[model samples]
Target: MLVSRQTTVHPVAAPPLQVELADAPPPGVWMNSPQGSAGTIGGVGLRLLQALSAAASIAVMASTGVFPSFSAFSYLIAAASLQCLWSLAPAFVYIYALLVKRSLLNLRAMFIFSVGDWITGTLTLSAACASAGVTIVIDNDRKICAGNLCARFMTAIGMAFISWFALAPSFLFNFVLVVTTFASLLAP
Candidate 1:
């Protein structure tokens, strides 16, 4: 005799697994964070302004056709050109950071940025001041500025000043970041 066994299969239902993903940091939080200002929108804007003003200064001075005669004007052109290139490099990096929604301000980067800003800011200020002094002297003398040369020189000086003004904030911000970073490292 053969015996047949019948078996019934039962299905068990398991609870669904829930996964929690971390949300991205908000703009205000990251923008104001001490990580570094170089990656922020405002930082990028300031850099662009500096670059544009510096380039404008170079262009205006070049158009004057008399900058080659004055050592001060030549110095201004060099400084402005340097400032433009420097500002542009950081602006590009900041723009990339913004696109990826990331901050580009590590400790090393902050220190480097601080140093660069200081050097460029000093050079820009010196160039602007020197050019301004020369321009004033030329303006005061009727023989030197008989044409529109003085006016063009004045405009270039103004642009250089604007570039330096924009650089000032960036320098201060980067300096603060470096100081805070070092302080935190040395803290108990």
Candidate 2:
């Protein structure tokens, strides 16, 4: 006599489910998020304006041929130089991002942009103020204001102010991004 054996089969277990964080932003949201005037075209425009104004400031001051006479003028030159570089590098990145239809508003990038803009803006403002005060003092002395030298100094100061103004919006936008990102991360 032959005996037959019965086999039992066990069911397989399902994979665990993935639970996304409730506070996490949706994918691509940062890409299309509002950045005030720091959006693609706006960012490029602002950066270009900043770069142009800063360069113009430097050119005007240098054209005076006597900028070396005052320490304030030297400081203005250094500040404007920094502002020009800061604005130009971002302008190029904005241009590339625009052409590629990509967003450059990542957390790390925005933080860096915010800090850089703040530092550059502060330098520009301080330099402009110092230069303006020096120019005013020089203008009051008829002996120093004999020519158009003071006028040129005034023009350069104006350009430095303009550059600072152009940078304001970008700094605010990036600063907001950094703050909000951190806030969200810390929130329950």
Candidate 3:
């Protein structure tokens, strides 16, 4: 008689590195990328507005030659560079969506995202104005008044409206989506 041995087989799992890489797919669809949607386009555009605002502020500061730094030009560049980070937020959001494997973003979620953009945009715009005010003060424009507060407030509100405008199309898109989603859910 011959003795027979039993054999067992186990499935091998992917290596950790491979799994990690598989989880991190590059997003190719426009839905996740800034170029795919209007909201992101607006984000990039508004970021340009902020950068220009920052640059204008730096220019004013530089023209005055009032900064007490050894290399005033360097400081101006530094200040402008700091504001340039806004240009990257849209790309960052796109990457974040990619990391989550998000292909089709929900409209309501887009609306919520717009709200976030609005908050950030308004805050940034307000800060830009305040920075301009600070620069004015630094340049010895001591004609300070309660009017400046009103001016800043108005500027922020105006900028907030622009942010709202940026969100408007996306907001409508989201509303349609939300209604459609609900309708689909309710359909027999």
Best lDDT goes to which candidate? 2
Q: Evaluate all candidate structures by whole-model CA lDDT and list the values in order.
A: 0.86, 0.87, 0.46
Estimate the TM-score for candidate 3: 0.34
- Residue 56, candidate 3: C-alpha displacement in angstroms: 14
Global CA lDDT computed for model 1 = 0.86
Better of 1 and 2 by lDDT: 2
> What lDDT, from 0 to 1, does candidate 3 have?
0.46
* lDDT, candidate 2, 44-117, per-residue tens: 88899999999999999999989998999999999999999999998888888768666676788888899999
The alpha-carbon lDDT assigned to residue 114 of candidate 3 equals 53
Residue 178, model 2: lDDT of: 84
- Runs of candidate 1 with Cα error greater than 4 angstroms are 1-31, 34-36
Worst 10-residue lDDT window, candidate 3:
29-38
Q: Tell me the TM-score of each prediction against the true structure.
A: 0.83, 0.82, 0.34
lDDT for each residue of candidate 3 in 1-188, tens digit (9 for 90 to 100): 99987698788987677344543434533323334343344444554555455455445444444333324334433544454444345445655654555544555565554555445445444554454455456334765334344344334334433433443444354455556655766999
Off by over 4 Å in 2: 1-28, 35-39, 141-143
| Number of the top TM-score candidate | 1
